[model samples]
Structure formats: structure tokens, C-alpha cells
Target: MAVDLENPSNYLTTRVRQAVNWGRKYSLWPLPFGVACCAIEFMSTVSSYNDISRFGAELVRFSPRQSDLMIIAGTISYKQAPILKTIYAQMAEPRWVIAMGACASSGGFYNNYSTLQGADRVIPVDMYVAGCPPTPENLLYALTQIQERVEREGLVPAAVRHAGRVQV
Candidate 1:
């Protein structure tokens, strides 16, 4: 097949799509909202060991206002649940939440009392990373999942939860 470089119709849509895809492929900054123990693992994932920079997520924002992803790490106490909810709400649209650690995902051993049953009770979690305190490798895996989710959904904010039960 001969290439038609001069024709306006030739590969115009393809070129536009490629450019859009390339821009979206890069530039994903995850906001680490680590409250406790799992924070250590979160740090390692971005640090020298796991090296999250390779995936273009090296810039982990501490402020929810500037972040597109919120990583809820460690236990969400009753006292902290409101704060977490507020923070997640503050993040820009097209944001994602990763519930890291058993404590964050299911409240771990603190199920009986003050801790929240799960971070999901407070925010819409996109991914659940299991562990009393998930390892750096697990955190990276969770990050990869978040990236895949972003690519699949595009830039618009999709609410996975509406009024409690999962939105279908």
C-alpha cells in the first residue's frame, strides 16, 4: 500500500487519536493520603525501592486539591473517617481512591470498636490492596491497577458509588 502523506483525509483521525492517547498515557499524579502504618509502604513504593517514577507517577501530591488520585492507607478511625471523606471530596474530579491495607479496606482487627468497617464506608474506593500493611510491591501493583482504570475510563469523573450501594 502506498502512503498518502499529502491527503487531508489520510490518517487524520488516527493521528489525532494517537496524540490524545499519548498525552493521557503520561501525567498521572497519585495523591497519597496515608494516615498510619501503611504510609511506610506508600513511601517505599515512590522511593528508591519500588521506584514509581518509571510509570510517570513520581509526583505524589500531599494536597487533595492538586491530586487526581487518593490512596487511603491504614486504619480509618471513627475520628478520622470524616476527615478522610472530606479530603476525598476535595480532590479534583476524575479522581480515584485506593484502599491500602486491611485496616483501610476492612478495618483489620479493630472491627469491634472505634475503627471504621472500611474506608469504602467513607469514600468510593477504586482498588482494594489487602494486607495488615501492604508491601511496596503491592502498592505498585495497586498503582498499576489505578493506571489501567484511568486509561479505561478517560478523564471524566465516574462515580462508582451513589447514595451508598455500588452504582450500576
Candidate 2:
């Protein structure tokens, strides 16, 4: 192949930072914190039927220490809030969180004091999927939204930007 000095198309910027971000966007290691009925739907989203792997998020990491993406799938009682916060703190940097259903987003129907109004109160959420127990499709859509956001934002830490803005 003849080299063209003036050609922009011949170059693919492979800077170390951008290269890492590219991998992070595609190979999101999800740590599912499934708690209730929504957990069931989360399962379907990862199953062979829906195949979340198509988005490069197939490997589900049970250990928060090893994962970058956290999906909170159900209600969080007041007593559990602290625990959730601890777990969030344990996860490595460049982590992103997905509040996967109405319950995780806003405590669903548990409007009482025992249930935290939202998981966001404890940890910042990068995406929210609406539904009592959102459909697998909705969850998939949420994943795509997260991917797009990641693409736009690169390796920006969700905690730094949204730490003070986790109102939802």
C-alpha cells in the first residue's frame, strides 16, 4: 500500500487512553445486584433468549472488585442502604451503575420508610430503566444507552460527575 501523507482516512488514532475507553465501552463487566422480581427479568436479559452478549456485556461478574458495571435490579430497604454504599465503594474506579427497574430507581410500590426511595441515594446511577420490573428489551435498551453514554464520555467516572447529582 502506498502511503499518502495528506490522507486523514489512513490514520486510526490509537492513543492509549482512547484504546482503553474503547475496550471499556464494548466489554462492560456487569456485576448484577439482583434483589427482587426485577432480578428475574435481569436474568432473561442475560440469557440466551435476549443475549445481552451481543452488546459485549455477556460475562457477568459476581465480585464487585472485578467488575466495572453494576446493575441494581430491585428494591433496597433502609437497612440495606449502607451495605449497598459499601459495595459501591468497593468496586474499582471507572464504574457505571444501572438502576434496572422502578424499584431500584424509586423503591417501586414500597413507599414506606423502610424502603429507600431510590438506590441512587446510596450510589450514583448511570442509567435508569423504567417499569415495576422492566422487560428484558427495556433492560437491553438501557444497556445500549449506557454504551452510547460511555462512548460519548469515555472513561469519566460516574461517581465524580454524578456523586452530587444522584437525585433520581
Candidate 3:
């Protein structure tokens, strides 16, 4: 089963899983759930300077139905938790979530009764970008990490995949 490295046919001999993962990794349409200060940073990430479009996530769809990635980029107050859950539930299957910023990831300095502590309390998060308000570059780096995860693991629904894990 020795294969020639220089052969052109070898280039096309990718497995079905790899092919599917490749397509899913690049076509992630993000649903930016911006709610607070971190929202501003998320906006900057998509702006011309950061240009998230370069990674195939330029189409920031507001409607959950049209998106596959949910970027929760701010604080999630108790009142807003239900709304966030509703939106996450509405997103199409094979959806992924990113907790973008300290606020969204763990309530940041707003460790009060109103804030939910973390976006993961409402929906499963696949990637978490840290910082009170993470820079656009940080957001971009997180996106690339997510891309790498998708490429390696394929698009399995987080709930189904992590059902065995204990929720903390």
C-alpha cells in the first residue's frame, strides 16, 4: 500500500469525513448575539481592519435560522438568558457557539444577581474568547481555533456530543 507522494491522484484521495469537515469549516455563517460592551469589540472584529470575511464568516446574519455559528459577544443578564436560549434553539442543526469576551464567558466583573455568569448556562459553547473586552485580533484567533476544531471534529451538535459530560 505504498503511495507516491508526487502523484497528483494522491492529492484527491481525501476521506469523506475530511471532505465534509472542510466544507463545514469554511461555510460558517455567524449569528452575532451582541448585547453589551463586548458587542462593540465583536463589531470591530467584523470591520474592515479585522475583516472576518477572510475566514468565511463575513455574512453576519441576524436571523438565527440563517446562521450556523452563534457568537455570544457580551454579558448575558438573567432577563436576557431566556432570549438567548430561544435564539440558540432556533439556529439550524450543526450549530456552534462561541462565548466571546469575559462577560459572555463568565459575567466578568458583573458577578451580580442580574448577570447569568456565563453564556454556557443558556447554551453549550464550543469556543470561549477571554478578556473584559477582547481585541478584534483575539476574536479572530478564536475564530481560527474554532475553524480548526471543526476541521478536526466535523460538525456534530454540541448537545449530542457532550451529553455525557457533567454540566457545572
Model 2 residue 143 CA deviation in Å: 0.8
Q: lDDT of each model, Cα atoms only?
A: 0.79, 0.87, 0.87
What TM-score does model 3 achieve against the real structure?
A: 0.89
Candidate 2: tens digits of C-alpha lDDT, residues 43-88:
9999999999999999999999999899998899998888888888
Q: What is the C-alpha RMSD of each candidate to the true structure, in Å?
A: 4.4, 4.3, 4.0
Stretches > 4 Å off in candidate 2: 1-19, 166-168
- TM-score of every model? 0.83, 0.86, 0.89
- Counted clashes in each candidate structure: 0, 0, 0
Cα lDDT, model 1, residue 10: 67
Q: lDDT tens digits, residues 1-168, model 1?
A: 989889987664446545664566567778888889999888888888789888888888988898887888888999998788788778887777789999999898886779899888767787899887988888888888877655655665746433355432
Ordered from best to worst lDDT, the candidate numbers read: 3, 2, 1
Q: Name the TM-score of candidate 2.
A: 0.86
Which sequence of candidate numbers ranks them by TM-score, best first? 3, 2, 1
The residue ranges of model 3 lying beyond 4 angstroms of the native Cα positions read 1-11, 164-168
